[model samples]
Target chain A: MFRIAIEMLLYDKTKYIGLLIGVAFTAFLVTFAMGYFAGFMTRGFALVSENPSAKVWVMDPSVSSAEATINMSDSALDIVRGVKGVNYAAPMYLGNMTARYANGDFQTFQAIGVDDATLSGAPKPANLLRIPESAIVDSGGTEGKLQTPIYKKDMWSYDGSHLNAPTRKLRYGDTMLINSKRVVVAGVSHTIPRFPPRPLLYTTASNFKRLVPGEKRYITFIMVRPTKNITPNKLAKRIAKQTGLKAITSDEFKKETVLWYMINSEDVGDMVNMVILAMLVGFGVTGVMLYMFTYENIKQYAVLKAMGASTKQLSDMIFTQVFISAIIGSGIGVGIAAILAHMVSSATFPFRMMWFAPLIGFLGVIIVSMTAAFISLRPIKKMEPGIVFKL
Target chain B: MSKIISTCRDIVKNFNSGEAEVKALQGITLDVYENELLMLVGPSGCGKTTFVSVLSGLLSFDSGVCKLMGEDISTMSDERLTAFRGKNIGFVFQAFNLLPSLSAIENVALPLTVEKRKRVETLTLSKEMLEAVGLDGKENVKPSGLSGGEQQRVAIARALVHNPKFIICDEPTSSLDHKSGQIVMELLTEIIKEKGASMIVVTHDNRIYKYADRIVHMEDGRIVKVAS
Candidate 1:
């Protein structure tokens, strides 16, 4: 009987293909949309992820996310260091500044300041280009437009504001201007691109204060490491208690950053709407196609009923058809999504195919198939066996 | 005398078509005996098809007593009635009603499969039944590939494959040519006699009336005459 059900569904190649297409489209769209959402949220806490050595972060009480932080008093660093479980605390400065290329091209950049002695929050060298231990280096220019140009003694500025054509990519020993002061490009660093992409510039705290020229008490956050045998969460609690600031573990901070973006950003709402639209299309297409398929074969069902097939047997056959469609269609859809995810994925545009993406796609397709099966069953349940004789 | 296999008494069925009530069957009373081919001949709207539907438990009579082999079918639940039908009765439809997706052998094996019989045994039985119906070398041919007479033969083979005690046929030969109709009727009556099963064939075609052991004529939902 199960075999017979499969035969009946497979006999109509048109409807069978239609059903598969409907399910596959749903799965693909849902998976890609959700994957994009996951990737975007991950970038929301890019700062926390970059500085894994920082077990805890102590920030101003008003700070909601990494990108939304307010400057804290420079003295807060010493207070955090005084906590019992704290091993080390470093004052970090985060600000946006403009850098002028040798061609006289100026571009805004995200400037990060680490401790001059330790360079505590700097990107790990294992994941980046190796630099000399003695060189005073700054890193940026991972993007195409931000790449620096080699200097030419005889060449003057093409536009006097932006370079018309860059002769060569920037390398070590190239010089750029920051705040009208010459700054040499010592090393290039690779990092995950920030949301609303901006090139990053890393420098020591003293250099940042000198380059930007600001008032006193300019520390944005204090990155702290817990002492041996003390957990990050425990240290964070102690720091918050001592400094009367918002202190949280790195993971907790990341979550808070993502949550703030989810609540405040319109982009999240747009992504959610795409997911809902995909679901509706899935349900509508599958339900209507299944119903149409069943309607076309109603006479066959009547013949089966009149020939003494019990309702349970017939129902099982219909469900069997639906189950097969759901599995095959979902597999095809997820496979397509994975391929597309591989193609369009980049550091700037976040698209992560998390393990849950396929599971969610499969579950969603199953639900659509089941709803379609129920819709198709309505007519069969109401059919009279005697109608076989009439038809 | 042939053993009585089924009895129908005072069966009345009315159907509602919007605001009007149409009487499909009026006080139909008949007996079907074992190893006999009974023909119910009537024009359209004369209730022969409705009577067989009630007798075969495919329909509910507004008021009647319908019993198959001593069990009252009208009192049976849908599940029980369907089970009983699968175990004891077979059907042949006007259009052959063969599933186009399935080959002749699979069509013939349907009743046994519906009962969830062993696959090997069901196929063997179905093949033999097809052979008996003179469809020996065409077991794997689907209905679309078969001629009308060949398709009807497959339907007859399906009806007899499960060894049911009763068979109900509605306009079994109405769609075939005269010669094909004659061939189908000969094949059907011969198989029923060999299997010792009773059959009720409802049709208005008079060309094959000679195959009947008994004939009941109906008019306006009532039995008009009985001929033998």
Candidate 2:
């Protein structure tokens, strides 16, 4: 009976293919949209992700996320260090600065200023930096939005600023003006992108102060490592209690960052909407197609009924057809999504192949299949076996 | 005296078409005996189909008794009736109602499969039945791949595969040519006789009436005459 059901489904090549495509489209659209959403949220807390060793983050009380920062007073670093169970603490500066390339192209960057000595919160190969003198650009930005022009004989004018030169990539020793101050790119670090997607520049706290002058205090966050015996949560609470500032474990800060982005960003809402719409479309198409398939074969079902097939046997046959389509369609959909994720991520878009995305898509396909099967069962249930004689 | 395999007593069945009630069968009374081919011949709308449908348990009568092999079918629940039909009655349809997706052997195996028989056993029985119906070496051919005569042969094989007490054939030769119809009737009558099972063939085609052991004529939802 199961084999017969499968053969019946496969008998009409056009209908079977249409059903698969409907299910596959749904799975692909939902999974890809949700994956992009997760990728963007992950980038919402890129700073925390970079500094895995910093278990606790101390910030001004008003700060909700790493991107939405308020500069803490310089004394907050000392206060965090003085707290019990605090192993080591370092002040970090986060501020936006305009970079003017030699070719006079100006771009805004999120400048991250780590401790000159320990380089806390800096993405590595930051340890290889000559203490406070130079900067590192994120690898993604080096390929996009931040390219420097290479010289061409006919492309250049008298002065370098107006030169219409063919571009070569920025590399080591590329110098740019940061807030009218000269800074050299010492190394390129591979870092996760930010939510709003700006180029990241890493430098020392001293260099940061030099680039953006005349601030009384410039510490945006203090990265703290808890003592071996104390958990980061306990240390954060102690630090918060002592300093009257917001101190939270890295995981908590990441959650807050993701939550803040989810609340504030319209892109998240759009992605979620797309996922829901895709699911609905998938469900509708599958349901309609299955119903049509069953209706077209209503006579065949009557024949079966008149030949003595029970209602349960007919139900099993319908369900069997549905589940087979669901499993295969979902598998094909997820496979396409994985390939798309790889292609889009290589093009520097926010897409992560999270494990749960495919699982959710597969489950969604199953649900759609089940609904379609139920819809198709209506004709079978109302069918009279006597109709076989007439039809 | 042939053993009586089925009895239908004053069976009445009605249909609702819009606001009007159409009487499809009016007090039909008949008996089907073992190892006999009973033909119910009538013009369209004469209740021949309705009578067989009730007798075969594919339909229910409003107020009458239809007993097949000594069991009252109208009193059986849907589930029990379906099981009984699966185990007792075989059907051959006007259009050869073989599933287009299934091969000849698979079509023949359908009744036994409905009875929850083992796959190997069903296939073995189906293969033999197809051979008996002169469809050897065409077991893997789908209905569309076979001619009308061949398709009807597969349908006949299916009807007899489960070794039912009786076969109900509705317009079995309507779609076949003269020669094909004769061949199908010859094969059907020969197989039913060999199995000692009765058959009820409801058709308007008079060409194949010579194969019947008993013929019942119907008109305006009533039995008009009986001949042997």
Candidate 3:
């Protein structure tokens, strides 16, 4: 019986091509929408997903996510480092600074400063500690737009003033003036595109001290790593009790970041709206296409019923046919969507193809297709078995 | 002495439309005996189809008693009636209503499959029935691919595949050409003789009356005459 249903569906391919195309298009749109949504959310928290060393984060009680700045005394780091079951802790300085290049291209960048000896503890390179008056920039920010020219000279002049040359051109790297001090680029790191989609420059605490004098030895946050037999939350509680500040585990911070993105990020809302629209479009396309397909075969169904087919058998046949169509059409749709996502990612699009996005999209297509097929049962139930002999 | 396979008593069917009640079958009572080919001849707008539908347990009468093999069919539930019909009653329609999706053998095997029989046994029996109806080489062809005569032959094979105790045909050859109609009637008669199953066929075509063991003529929802 299932074989019969399949044959019937395949027999009139030309007649049902429109329906197949409709379902396929719906599936493609749904997958594309969901893929983009997942990509956007992941990128929104790339900083949290990539950070490896910081087991707990201490913040002001008012702060909710990484993008929020919580002011705390520099003494907190020392107190956390001295606690039992504590391995190491370091102060991290974060601020926004405007950078001006020789070509009159001005860009706002996040300034991150760590103690010279404890740079590795905060997930920064040791090379950044050795390069005085120099910073490491995020590669993704510069790789495409600012194709800096590579030069081997030890020194270079920007705005007719001599500054130490960058060790590497570093994609978007350039000699820039920060608060009347020259800072060269020493290396490039993988880009992290969390809340603020801007270039990042990592420097030592000494450079921060020199550039912004009398700024008070105040760090925005602290990073900590625990020793054996110590959970992050327990260490965080101990640190909080001793330092008079809040301490958060990395997982807690990640959850807060996601919540912050959902509530505060403008793009997140827009992407969610786009996903809802895509689902509606999918429902519309599938419903209309499948309804029309069943309508065209109404007489055939009547004939089958008149020939002594039970309602269960007829309904089962119809369901089998729809299931086959959904599988084939969604398979093609997801295949196309994956290729499209890859192409977009390779290009200049701010998209990431997470490993789980395809699975979610495929499941979405099946759910939407089954819903459409179920709606088509109304007309089938109304079919009269006696109509076959009327003609 | 032939056994009485089906009996209808005091069958009455009415149609209601906007406060108007129209009588379709006025106390139709008839008996169909074993190993006999009976034809119910009637004109348009008569109750021949309604009477047959009630007899086959496919429709409910307003008031009537229908018995098949000494069991009251009118009181049977839909599920039980369906099972009973699949087991003991076979039907052939004038449209040669074979599913276009299935081949001739598949169409013939439908009743057996509905009975939850093994596929091998069903297919083998269906193939044999098709061959018995003189459709040996066309088992793989769908009804749409066959001619009217071949399609009718497939329908007859489906009706006979389950070895039912009785066969009910509604204008079985009405859609065929004269020669094709004659062929279908002859094949049906041959099958009834070979299998010893009683048959009741309704038709207005008088040319095929020679194959009937008894003929019942009807008018205005009432039986007018009976001839044997």
Candidate 4:
């Protein structure tokens, strides 16, 4: 019976191919949309995820996400360090600053600052530790962009890998001006980019203060690590009570960042809407095509019924048809999605196909196909076997 | 000479076509004997097809009994009817109704598949049936590629592949040329005799009348006469 169902579906070449395409396109749309959403979420929480050793983060009461941080007074670091369960705490400075290149092109970079002594928040590099009065540039996607020339075509020596290159350039200490002060380029780090793509530059807190001298006690956050016996959430609560500041566990801060973006940014809202629209279009096309296919094959179904095929047998045949379509279509969709993910991984855009995205999309297509199958089954159920005798 | 394979008495069916009651089968009484070729013949809308439908368990009659192999078709549950039909009855159609994606052997293997038989065994039997119907070497050909006569041969093999007790054919050769029609009729009769199965062949082609053991004519939803 399954053989017959498949054969019947394949009998009409045009309809069979059209049905497969419908299912495949739907699967593609679902996976791609979910993949994009996954990328956004990863970028939103990347800062917290990058420093896996940090247990908790201390910031001003208004700080919600990496991008929504408010400057905390430098004194907050000593206060957090004094609280119980604190193994060590250091100030992490972050700010958006325009960097003027050697060729006079100015671009915005997320300047991430760590204390000179500990190098807590910055990307750890062997060459960075060796070089003095120099900064690390994140080159995740700088092949052709503003920072590409600085790290690629310039006089820099290639060192470590591209994501974590161990090289430097600055013929006789080349420098770039950020607020009228020249800073040396030491090395490049291949850290993942944030959602709202901005180039990253790693520097010391002292250099950060040197670049922006207006704020005397500028400390964006104080990253903390708990002792062996204490949990981060418990330590965070104790610190917040002692310093009258918002001390949150890294997980809480990560969630807050994603929520803040979802609520406050129109672009984030648009992305979510796009995902939903893809789902609607995918399901809609598959449903209509399957229904039309079933309608066209009503006579064949009647013939089968007249031949004494049990209702269960007939139902299984229909379900099997849809099941096969969904599986094949989903395989193609996931394959294309993986290829798409690979294509944009090197670009400046934040695109990621998470482990669960494709699985979810595949399951979603199955559900849609099943629904379409039921819709197609209604007409078959009502078909009269007497039609087979019609001239 | 043989036991009764199917019997219908005072079978009636009606349809409501736009406020008018159309009596498609006013009263149909028929009996098919084992190993007999019974042809139901009539003009258009004469209930010949309806009588065949009821006899084959594909149609229901109003307030009448239809018994196949001494079991009442109306008294059986839907599932029982389907199982009975799949196991005991075979059907052929005017269009040949050969699935285009399946080869001749696969179409013949359908009844066994419905019976949940193993694929290898069903195909082996289907191949033999096709060969018996003079479709040798054509088992792998799809219906689309086969000529009208070959397609009808495949259809007959499909109908009889399970060795059902009865076979039903609806205008089995209406679309064929006279030569192909005669060939199909000969093959159908020979195969029925070989299987010892009763058959109800509803057809308008008069050229195949000679193959029938008995012929019943219908007109205006009633049996007009029996010709032998």
Please tell me which predicted candidate would have the highest lDDT against the true structure. 2
lDDT (Cα, tens digit) per residue for candidate 2, span A244-294: 999999999999998887787787677677767777876687677767877
DockQ of each: 0.65, 0.64, 0.29, 0.48
For B167-193, candidate 4 gives per-residue lDDT tens digits of 999999898999899888888888888
Question: lDDT: which is higher, 3 or 4?
Answer: 4
Query: For candidate 4, what is the DockQ?
Result: 0.48
Q: Kindly list the per-residue Cα lDDT of model 3 for residues B1-228, writing each as its tens digit.
A: 789999999999888855697788999999999998999998987888888878877667888789999999878866576677778877888877787778899989988877768999999999999989899989999888899989989999998999998898989888999999999999999888999999999998999999999999988889999999
How many clashes in each structure?
Answer: 0, 0, 0, 3
Q: Which pairs of residues collide in model 1?
A: none
**Could you tell me which residue pairs clash in candidate 3?**
none
Chain A only: give the TM-score of model 4: 0.83
lDDT of 3 by residue, A1-391 (tens): 6777787888776855766676677777877777776666666556556656878877766778777675567776777778887787777777777766544345567777877786742334556547668877664333443223345333234454323333334442457777778877766676555444667777887787676667754677778888878999999888888777778888888778778878987878877787888778776878777777777787777655544566677778778877777777777877888899889877746566666666666677667667766776777676644455465
Q: Give lDDT for model 2.
A: 0.86
Give the Cα lDDT of each candidate. Answer: 0.82, 0.86, 0.76, 0.82
Chain B TM-score of every predicted model: 0.97, 0.97, 0.97, 0.96
The candidate with the higher lDDT, 1 or 2, is 2
Runs of candidate 1 exceeding 4 Å displacement: A84-88, A98-107, A123-188, A211-217, A225-244, A346-349, B1-3, B18-21
TM-scores of the candidates are 0.87, 0.87, 0.83, 0.82
- The alpha-carbon lDDT assigned to residue B222 of candidate 3 equals 90
Best of the two (2, 3) by DockQ: 2
